[model samples]
Target: MSGTDEASAREALRSGDLTIIGRIRSASNATFLCEATCSDEVVHCVYKPVAGEQPLWDFPDGTLAGRELGAYLVSTALGWNIVPYTIIRDGPAGPGMLQRWVDQPGDSDEVEPEGPDLVDICPPESVPPGYLSVLRAYDHVGNDVILVHADDRRLYRMAVFDVIVNNADRKGGHILTGVDNRVYGVDHGVSLHVQDKLRTVLWGWAGKPIDDETLESVAVLGEQLAGPLADQLREHITADEIEALRWRVGALLREPVMPGPDRHRPIPWPAF
Candidate 1:
């Protein structure tokens, strides 16, 4: 996709009073992030096409439509900003989803990186200490960086969430440091796994044990799971599916880790 395609899509979105303005750029799939026409808007308008390529994981029947809907539903329910916003209609690319684009920190007018996302500064051991604090803050409740303290409790909670979701790509780069220096995690295309695909650097805190704050957060999520969250997931996903999410969250809250294959110690090669 190109700027022309984004511009046309942005026009359609604004015609509906979506408030997206300025030049639009296609970051990935059918999604575009554009400057907000209104002042005091901290977020960029995100748009996604209704149809696109199938993801790496196989959904219920390997259906593209079903998979897209599933991604949107689960991410919203979990309160994790995964799939971009969607607009259902005919477009230059045919029917698709249009969502608010994720604001990335880079030269806005320049060409953005098209290669695999950089997860951390080269050499994990060499990462600066402040960035680690940024990662811890990203998973917390507050957007105010000063109000948020990077402690053990929040890290354990995020790790449990990653574990239950079977998050395959929690690379350091996937976590974003916003203008406030408060971290925000993105790119969860490979979560809620049926296989053993938990790959993350967060395991370093494994033996450190869970804290009260994380336990309380898990309990809150568990309670939400059976109510509104369950209702939300029921629309696009299976009842069993919602139950599985609840079970995973409960299991993690109850127990920290499961026995793993000895070979799991070695990190994936060419670590992304």
Candidate 2:
């Protein structure tokens, strides 16, 4: 079957029959790589069941799947399209969130031998002049490696989205470089907390000014939070959490600059 559009993808996730093709063991939660068949087309989706989530001290139990969907809604409202199309539905395991899988290009990780556009992986010295350092790491062999991302506009947009959502866990692996050359973010179950726990690797733009277009997008999102989006969020999260989201939006709009990392728990452990 051919690939489906966003609307069709959402429909498939909602009504399709999910067949577990494999298990993604790397995730802390019980995540499944599934094939969802709606009508004539088969779409690939990642399913995270509420039943499989580990209890956390801060976030309420049985609400992570909804938060995953909430992140997608916020991304769509801002017109950033950072998160893939996602929906809450009943799957093989139980009720959960199913998101369309992004197919990333191989070139995202490949390194060229000799070219101006060579992709560098690890080692602080290998990073190109314009690239921004994201985090530092040590390999298993005790060698120093520096993680960095290209200085791109899409990265900036994603940073803004994470700030608005109060994302608590934004790791390097969560940022997918799709085959279409667009960046998509995944695994947002830990976001939208009522507390100020915005840990991420996209701090390269910290204290930087946000452009007009991005500011306009934030403004539009702020308006939506006061309207129907607020109503929709109430079905998934507590009223307090929704209000906290509003507070974050206002703070970002007022400053329009990237805030520095928290003194305590600034970055996610195992950043990649």
Candidate 3:
């Protein structure tokens, strides 16, 4: 997004009037497609109301919206801009997390289809040469299918950001190519837990060394946590969770590389 568009998007999400357009039926939570209007600025966005969130065994009820906002703040602090512009405010459905919607290209569902969808599943032999194979599995009919993601830099940075937030669900569909052609991640309600529950599909960079630029971003994030970021996060997550975030950043800087996946439950179910 351009500078003016970014400013307008933030304004719309912060104090705009939100009108429910329709429900995003495929979402696990009660997510709605909304039209946010502020003065003359308007944009379509995704709104997930606290009242509509499903109770999860691990996360406390009604806290998902705050977590989503918290994740956005951390993303901004890191300067990765992985998450879209988001905020916690009163909507038509009550209070919720509102984020500017990104427009992705129209494409086919075929294994080798086109456009900005970086992650896909295809037959083992048909996997794209430029993509990194993540896992080998089977379809309902038992045909072989391999989950793969592109060897792109933007997506790689998102994977690093996911580690910092301890994102619990980073499915393939959550990774989108924005209208600006930047890679973005969404659906962060289950992120930033005190415990390590980092399940995601972007393990293509597993065990790779972190680049200097990304390490610098992580270091900046650590310093910010000591300043204003800590205070900002305290509003959404528990003090313990924020501390865990600090530890994660420090540990990453010490290691300076992408992490290997946990043999147990490394990826989210329904991978897409």
Candidate 4:
């Protein structure tokens, strides 16, 4: 039921016999929970078919799957492992994205009780210690609550990765704590736009200096864009979008600081 080798996992995802298990109804785009069996090893994954993509006014039709893969490529270039292993291939519905499912425990079959969330809404007066507050707001009933994310470094790394990709929908629900104890970000179908459309709930580290290590990673990613990474990204995004990524990276290295929320649409609707 498992394949740990990187090459093996990639091959399995690329050619494994896939069986749709169920639909994750919460997703706006059609999303299928599937079991991919390859070489007799089974791996659970999420599949989104291009045939089911909803038309967007801004983004071109049927390109979301490629955008998801583009985000994965940026994550890989940074050596951050921020995104799950992802690929685009033909499926029962048609060609689309195939991403390895992240187990809640990270790699276990035994289901563990859901643990503390990486992001949460808490009483304004009692934001959890070691958590940084993002926004203060009223919930459905009108009581005051604050949007907060963990003060953990992994989340910060994700936040930086978000900046690099210009992630436009980084809802709190998209952040996951996996079994290997790593924080991951998912659902990046609406990223890599040429225009600025950054929206997220991960503003806890806003206005802080990025760590030297991460800045170094950003520098490396900026350089990769002019070469192989840009070539691969062209399969999903436009030349202008790739160039915008280059611009964002250069700007970050010049500033080396976590950005404050933009004046327009700083956070996504329904923060959680």
Q: Show where candidate 2 strays beyond 4 Å.
A: 1-6, 107-121
In candidate 2, the residue pairs with backbone N, CA or C atoms under 3 Å apart (3 or more residues apart, or in different chains) clash, namely: none
Q: After superposition, how far is residue 214 of candidate 3 from its true place, in Å?
A: 0.9
TM-score between model 2 and native: 0.91
Query: TM-scores across all candidates?
Result: 0.59, 0.91, 0.95, 0.95
Candidate 1 whole-model C-alpha lDDT, 0 to 1: 0.48
Task: For residues 40-81, write the lDDT of model 3, one tens digit per residue.
Answer: 988989999999999999999999999999999999999888
* lDDT (10s digit) by residue, model 1, range 1-272: 47765566545454443433432332334454444342223335544444543455444432333334444554444554344444344334454444445456564667464532323422333343333322222214543331111333334445566665666566654545443323455545445545566666555454455556656666776787867766755664566655666777787678745323233532332233
Model 4 score (lDDT):
0.90
lDDT of each: 0.48, 0.85, 0.90, 0.90
Two-way lDDT contest, 1 vs 4, winner: 4
Q: Give the poorly placed runs of model 1, Cα more than 4 Å off.
A: 1-31, 34-43, 55-57, 60-99, 102-157, 257-270
Off by over 4 Å in 4: 1-6, 106-115
The root-mean-square deviation over C-alpha atoms between each candidate and the true structure, in angstroms, is: 10.3, 3.1, 2.5, 2.1
What lDDT score is found at residue 16 in candidate 1? 42
Candidate 1 TM-score over all chains jointly: 0.59
Winner of 1 and 3 under lDDT: 3
